[model samples]
Target: MQIAIRADSSKIIGTGHIMRCMTLAHALKNEGYFVTFYSRAHEGNLNNWLANQGMDVRIIPAGSNSIDQYSTAHGSWLGATQAEDIQATLNIINTVPDLWIVDHYGLDHVWHKAMATRSQVMVIDDLADRRYDACLLLDQNLGRKESDYAQLTNAKILAGVDYTLLRPEFIEQRQKASIRQGIKNIVISMGGVDLQNVSGIAFRTLLNSHLHELESITVVLGHANPHRADMQLLASQATHIQVEVVQGVSNMAEYFARADLCIGAAGATSWERCAVGLPTVLVQLAANQQIAAQQLTKVGAALSLDIGQLESHLEPVVKELANNSDKLMGMSRLAFSLIDAEGTTRVVKEIKSLFA
Candidate 1:
């Protein structure tokens, strides 16, 4: 099968989209499928990384962002004009693909509709916020239900963390790390690129909380984070905290093994944390993450906190979890149940079955 993916990674959008698609691409490759990528050449684009992975990438010039108009219209932190997006996508679809996979929040039905006519389009979305013109839709967050995409036209829904197509490394390490109890070893990973420097905010918040004095507090920042310097200073001030500012951590299993708890954004890491049985405090960083964060919270696996409410609720949360050991363990077990490491294999089998 010839598969092409529409995903981009940059300072603005972060690297999660390309990273997750790479996982799926690798799985498909191993199963004898030819995979290609269509990415925008934005600042910090993942063309180099994708090339390193031995996949053919077609790069398009970065789309124009109407900053003032976007902010005024939607109060959006990340917004692109529909015309620019449509043109970019049209340029990509000019070369037909057998299966087109799109993973972008800025795109909606307009792009989907145009691409769907040319290929069997599959959408990778965590947010059911927009209508999609897709044949198959994948939302690999905990507690995602098919009903969430009821409004989508002609969509085959693959919902929940059960379908999370994680990289092989995560699956390999899942069984190696037994759950650690009575330890306050926590991991703080915002994302590959935190545009607003939310990690610094989360770090400062941790310093003020009583949990700062816990046994071990490890801060994991990606190389692209703009606030690494500020985080370094914050880590210096907090003596109890052990901050590790790493770029590309090949041994992510080690971090997951060490973390008793994780405070992370509700993106790809949500499923990774669930797979490794790391209890999490989910913070919604973008509009797309809001539903996934709440859904995970409702499933008893994660504690959801709106970015705005973190200041007021964080103190009580820290005190409660630090004091109550049993409750923390329960949440950890709940998370462990949500994802199996073999999710990639399951998704692949389902896709192949569609052809059969």
Candidate 2:
């Protein structure tokens, strides 16, 4: 069977959608199914990266006009109107796929319905705010339930963290992961784009906190992060605390295993941190992240800090976690209990059943 994945990554759209799609695509490909990606050429887009990964990639040209005309809240992130996007996608695809996976917030039921004529539709979504026209719908947020999408669609729903599309590396890392004891090592990952440079703020907050036991702080930056140079320069100037800036990391699970604590954006990485039992201080980088951050904090799996509160609240929170070993151990235990590292397998089994 052939699969077509519709997802995008840009300065505004971020890379979480496409990254998770890649995880699913790889699983399908490994199971002897052909997979192709359909993405637009937005600024900081990962079209080329997807192509380099040995999958067939089809690129849609970004529109020349302003993005204000589209109606969806995130319509501007699509770089074109829904009609135009559908037309462009139709023009490029030579054959109808057995399954079309849609993973863009800017697109909803309207686009899905139009493409349904060509193939069966599957949607991978985080926000349950819109309706969908799909045979399968997957939302991997922590507290999500099928009732959340009751009014939206009748698609077979895969809700909650059990369906999170994590890479195979996380499973391997989980085997090596042990309970964290102290806050000697820290990791700051603010997502792939980090347009606002939150990693720098977190790094600066740690440096000024003057935690004498800190041996090293590792800051992970993506290939598309605009502030990579600025972060590298800042890391170079640090005298007291050793800060390492790593970009385009393929082995993030290793970093999670080595770190005692993580300061990260509350997006898809929330599940990754939980898989490795890494206690985190989550910052809500986008409005979509608000729910996950709140739920994680509520469940005692992690801590939360608003982006606006990072400067004021981050240092104090880190200090408290550093001084209390019991809290750190408790957080790790709770986090480890949430994920089983078999999400990809479970999702793939369902997709294969569609053919059986």
Candidate 3:
């Protein structure tokens, strides 16, 4: 079977879409299916990184035109009009794929319908604001309900965190994870591309805080992050705390397993932390992240904050959790209960069943 995945990553769109799509593609490939990625050459795109993972990648040349004004809320993220993207994608593939999986916020029903005529259409989405035309639709956010898409599409909906597309390593780490107690070690991951340098700000706040138990701090940065040098400079100045700046981490599961607390963005990484039962102070970096962050907080799975609250609330939240081991334990249990880390397996099974 041949599968074509349409997903993109750039400074504006972030890497969560492509990362989750890559997880699904890897699972499909393991089942003896040929998977190819169709991406655009956006500045800071992950086409090269996708190829480095041994997947067949076809890059559509970046267009010079501005995004259509009438496109979706994230239309500017596409770097081109929806019609142009549809044609460029059609011009690349030689044969129709058995399944065409799209995970982009910029493309909506128009693109989905255009692709559905040529292949079985599937969509990986979080926001339900737009319409879609697909055979299957997956939304892995905690608060998402099937009713949200009732007026939008007739596609079979796979909703909630149960269908979260996590990598295999997270499952392994979860099984081997130990009970987390007080916050001694911390990990800060503000997203793949921290355009606002939230990681550095969080690190600085921790340094000035009164957390005597903080032994070490691990800061994870993406390869596309332009603030890498600035982050490294901040880490170098940390005299008391043992700060380790790791770039482009492949072993995030291990880091989550070892850390007592995580200060990161409330994006897809929220699910990864939950997989390892790592308590976190989630900061909402984008508007789309608000729902997940608020839901996580309401469920006791995490403590939520906005970008503006990081300076004032971050340290106090971390200190309160560190001081109260019982609170930390409860959050870990709730976080672990939110996701089982078998999402990729279940999703892959569903996709294969489409052909069977």
**Error of model 3, residue 146, in angstroms:** 1.1
What 10-residue stretch in candidate 1 is worst by lDDT? 70-79
Candidate 2 deviant stretches above 4 angstroms: 64-70
Please say which candidate is ahead in TM-score: 2 or 3.
3
RMSD of 3: 1.0
Q: Model 3: how far is 147 from its true place, Å?
A: 1.2
Positional deviation of 184 in candidate 2, in angstroms? 0.5
lDDT of 2 by residue, 241-338 (tens): 87899988989899998899999999999999999999999999998898889999999989998788988998788888889999999999999999
Estimated TM-score for each candidate: 0.86, 0.97, 0.98
Clash counts for the predictions, in order: 0, 0, 0
Off by over 4 Å in 1: 66-95, 208-213, 238-241, 308-316
User: Per the 3 Å backbone cut-off, how many clashing residue pairs does candidate 3 have?
Assistant: 0
Q: Which candidate model has the greater lDDT, 1 or 3?
A: 3
- Record all residue pairs in model 1 with backbone atoms less than 3 Å apart, i.e. clashing: none
- Weakest 10 consecutive residues of candidate 3 by summed lDDT: 63-72
